[model samples]
Target: MTSESQTAGTRVLHLSSAQLARVSRALDGDEAAAAEFDSALSSDPVRLLVEVLSTKSVPAGSGVSYGHTFVTQHPTVLARVAIGYGHGLPRKAGNRAWVTWSAAGGPAVRLPIVGRVAMDEFVVDVGRTPVEPGQLMCVFGDSDEGEVPLGDWAAAIGESPVSVIACLDRRVTRSVVE
Candidate 1:
């Protein structure tokens, strides 16, 4: 069995048939499951990019998004993302998920979702970053650029990647990348 840890809390467990069964029992009490693993925690080909529709400044104690699930800690700028649970993103991601925003010609900055994820949109606290509309956000992309991983996204929202992908209906446009 092999496993590799990736950035953004992605871990892939590679196990053969026997090893896999052993792992299952090990989860019960077998200490033999402790071993280095070589798994598929590598960068994935699929990435989800969402656009920034708008941004706004809020004072401290400000409640963000629907239900006020999260409140502003201080004066910060919140940027709205263009996709949400209705678009296949997990609704549970509200205040639990993160996205990567790359400044124009700069490195990617990881931002947290500040409020409840809506039907077609979400919010990110872009603190201190002069973000603007039309900016592309890497909701889950390659780790090389500090983007979130699909696995991490699933874990954050308590779902599997398969389920997440299946939730992406025709309403969400699909683009092929080489």
Candidate 2:
């Protein structure tokens, strides 16, 4: 609904239920469903903050591009994350892309990708987090206290705020907490 400037160099873009509905229609084409989904995500206090990590090391001879690249080494922790380009994650996010994140009781962290990001899957370092399937990932939203933000990631990727919100699929679970 309103845009505010933060001291941390990130701009907070607020969206109301009505504004989010418009974006949902543009992305999903079902106004009713979109409205419902938007209502769920908007009402939540915990925001999404996607952190990309590298899964493998690219060889020196190999040049990693957008969607094509191979892991020349082993022991790669390929991050099977829930967020991807289809969810408004940036397509330009190549291998070794950086994202800021923080766990339930840990400090904010930064991680990188090891391989090319597929349509639905992208990798991350996950240095800690003890990641497992369905471990609650914040791909793009606000943070605890609405302080640490993911808005910079959207701007850096040249993605419109509306498009980012639309990218989030209805399948992703949403929860609200005070």
Candidate 3:
């Protein structure tokens, strides 16, 4: 298995425009090809996952229920990520939401939230992990041995994974890597 330092050096390698076009043309209606494409793009294409640290510390007692509980904490580190309730993240995940994240050397760490996810922000407890802004936050991507399947995440929050993925507006940018 690769170490954190090894994976951290790799830059964001995206698919070339020509290569994307070729794949698009080659797999017009082939199911297997489509599946392969999905696996390659979403899975560990580089045989490694990016390791990023938390930027801020979202405090406790911050009520996060939608149209319900009110946040009571001030110094909280809201995950400055793109995915939110509108992007399929559970709005009802009032302090129950957990995401598998990777720090330096330890196994993929599961970061628990303190409140419900807002329209564009979520809180995470970064006890002592050295994190900072612009770090790669794997909201819903690959994992070490298993993956945080979008379907499972949706099920946990009582939402349809299909609709959750579909609701990802065009504003949410996506990049394909080879």
Residue 117 displacement in candidate 2 (angstroms): 1.9
Give the higher-lDDT candidate: 1 or 2: 1
Ranking by TM-score: 1, 3, 2
Better of 2 and 3 by TM-score: 3
Error of 3 at 8 (Å): 22
Cα error, candidate 3, residue 2 (Å): 41
What does candidate 1's lDDT look like per residue over 132-166, in tens digits?
A: 88777887766776777766777788875445654
Q: Candidate 3: which pairs clash? A: 57-76, 57-77, 58-76, 58-77, 59-76, 63-71, 64-116
Over all chains combined, what TM-score does candidate 2 have? 0.52
TM-score of each: 0.74, 0.52, 0.53
Q: Quick one: RMSD of model 1? A: 11.1
Q: Report lDDT per candidate.
A: 0.67, 0.48, 0.46
Give the residue spans of candidate 1 off by over 4 A: 1-43
- Higher-TM-score candidate of 1 and 3: 1
lDDT of 3: 0.46
lDDT winner among the candidates? 1
Q: What is the lDDT of residue 153 in candidate 3?
A: 54
